[model samples]
Target: MPINSYDYYPLSWYPDSTRIKRPKYEAIITLLEEDIVSGVLKANTKLPSQRELADYLDINFTTVTRAYKLGVEKGLLYTNIGSGTFVSSNAFKSITISTDNSPAASIDLGLVSSFEQCNALLVPAIQKVAGQQTITQFLNYQAPTGTAFQKEIAIRWLSTLGVQTIPERLSIVSGVQNGLAIVLSALFSYGDRIVVDFYTYSNFIELAKLFHLTLIPISADLEGMSAIELEKICQLQEVKGIFLMPSCNNPTGSILSASRKKELISIIKAYQLIVIEDDIHAFLTAPFLADYSPPIYQSLPEQTVYLYGMTKFICSGLRVAYLVFPERFKNTLNRSMFNINVKTSSLDSEIITEVLHSGLAQQLLETKKALSQEANALFNTIFDCQEVTGHHPWPYFRCLPIPKHYSREYIETYFNQLGVNVYHSDRFVVKSDYEKAFIRVALSSSSSLEVLETGLLKIKEGLVGLE
Candidate 1:
């Protein structure tokens, strides 16, 4: 096999030749599976030889061989000694293909462009860091906790979160998702009750489901999660822990107030509940805000699990989010992670640290603020309809309430047809709700004001039609 042959063959070539818009091997498998299931290729029907198929399809022999293997795996075909592959007897039973042609869509709400810009600015710094003779330190297995410099940089970054902690309390993980997984794995078992805000980060819901943790949704207001409700739930159930996004809470764009934070802390202390503070969107808050603290548990450090993702503010591609354990839980969390992933990539840590120290993070944040303001302005202008209200001009996203009669699915479909994407209220819901009331329009850092305005106009047109 030529080294560059497969690499050189454009993905478009195979699909074009086959008159199949799907991936080459996937299409071949689909065709074979269909034939077998329909009895056009009977149970005992011998498949064309790889070379024959290759010639017939005007493609490479290797492609046909791969397709056959895939078909065999799907029980559509089987091979016997000295005989060619034949359709399996149970081929029809295994021929289930999902025909879900759901539209491919995404909401342009995240401010990850700032992260990308920071990453671009840090490339040289990263190269310089790697060029150091100490680069060998990263090549070998890194410490379970992370390197000293990495820890130092992480601590400095954590300070920005208003948590003044030593490296001992922090363990660097692959990313926020990994950190959440590790924390969940260490703290809770199946059927354990974990409390979360009604409108919380969607991924946390997924993580809770994966771990089989019972997610008890706490009610919330503009100041953030209801401390009283949380207290009630903690008392009623043996709530193992609480997962919260205290600062610039996602989807809702609500910031938990300082007084509310204190109250929540007191309640957690009373209930002795472990708190997982996902401050991923912490840095986006105006630094001067008196109530804003990057890590919510800076005061009650012990019972709090502080998760800070550098990716959200600094660089998303870095895949770095530290879990600052309350001093007592550090050893246990470290051990749990080691037993699973062994250690996170030292290279990523080094790169992230280099970027942080280079002042690129600050520059990126400034740019983000400016871009967010512009995007928000565009959002306001585009959705100026009387029905479209409740949009707080936050630099990141605006929440608009839908009419009682309108379904989120219908709105999403309408926007998608116009090449605009909007997140349905259900994306933020911890528990299912029949009424699709709110739609979140994120002012993405990547999108220009003109582009955003165009998208928003389409949304307005869609809503107008609905009205």
Candidate 2:
């Protein structure tokens, strides 16, 4: 192996030989990360072959392999099946939804706002809950799965969205994200594969990484995620579950139709995949669309954990949502809920119950819907929208497709520099090979109507010569 040092070829990365630490693998990752963060190695740059790197460094090939594996796990790199390993598309960018780092007057078009204008509508309910004689009941440490009264309210709140579920089968979690954590922790083992749409909620993507779950990215059509692709993936590998936002998918606003649901259900049944239905936005869309497909949970109740989030519609600060699961998984879900969340605040649950009971929740939904309409209309005036699902009730975010020339990295930083904080499509991507790109602009995030309008217009001006 030491036959010829003269035959060595140049590497994409030239690490300083003297700088590598004793344990070469960790040092390799450190230097690789340093190079990536410093911008010396750009996104999607293919790295040297593992064997070639090992030979160049005069170390065992397994060390380089371990280093490359660690790099992928760290989100600093990704590998295409046949193609060699390369830097992750999101390696150079920091994914976040906060404006803490943005300069003053920065219009936030990143975080999906719940249209905070509707929060004022909940004041009466909060006051009513505070005045009740039984207010101290919520302070008790009992009812980890919510009190009977709270579950009754959950049933009533769910009924509005056409969901039929009894108190025994339902659990009140803090939010959809919380329910998701319980499901993943209680059900799935590490390294389990789950299928997802090409582009999805960025938070979910990070959550999967945290749990070490492999996400098999599937292609999407006019109707959400494709069934044909699901079949192909199932045939190739074992997928434990699937995550879907069938009713108004986040970031893209794609909705799955009835016929398409049947197609996917067949695949789910054949594969026996646990369906994690995030119907968080159904309340906003179902009332408007007469022909909206019913939640998949209804068809496969035995194999689904349906989450209905009230954050975007009622009150985001309350951090309240509901989850309905089958009786078979009750023990595991309950145990995980107890371990992860000692209890989802009964105080927050009570206020939400009062809101639902007093009919303020309906008023809040209507007001939020009206605000959503105004925001969508404002977005339409500035940019052209290609309708994804039929009779689409504009979701909180809009996808603005861009030319290939507008790299995802540039779109993010450039937008922030122009006083707008938006996210590139790559932020929501799982493992897509699609060439098209876009940025997801949160229409409902701004403080007032005028602020949203100003942000959208700023984006239009920024695309002057790029488009």
Number of the predicted model whose TM-score against the real structure is largest: 2
Cα lDDT, all candidates: 0.68, 0.82
The digit string of per-residue lDDT tens for model 1 on 289-370 reads 5545445577778798888887667666777888888777867787779987788988888888887788776777777666
lDDT of 2 by residue, 133-187 (tens): 9889889888878889999988977776767889999999998888999999898
* CA deviation > 4 Å runs, candidate 2: 1-76, 79-83, 89-96, 384-391, 432-434
Model 2's alpha-carbon lDDT is: 0.82
TM-score of each: 0.72, 0.85
Report clash pairs, candidate 2: none
Alpha-carbon RMSD to native, per candidate: 16.0, 4.8
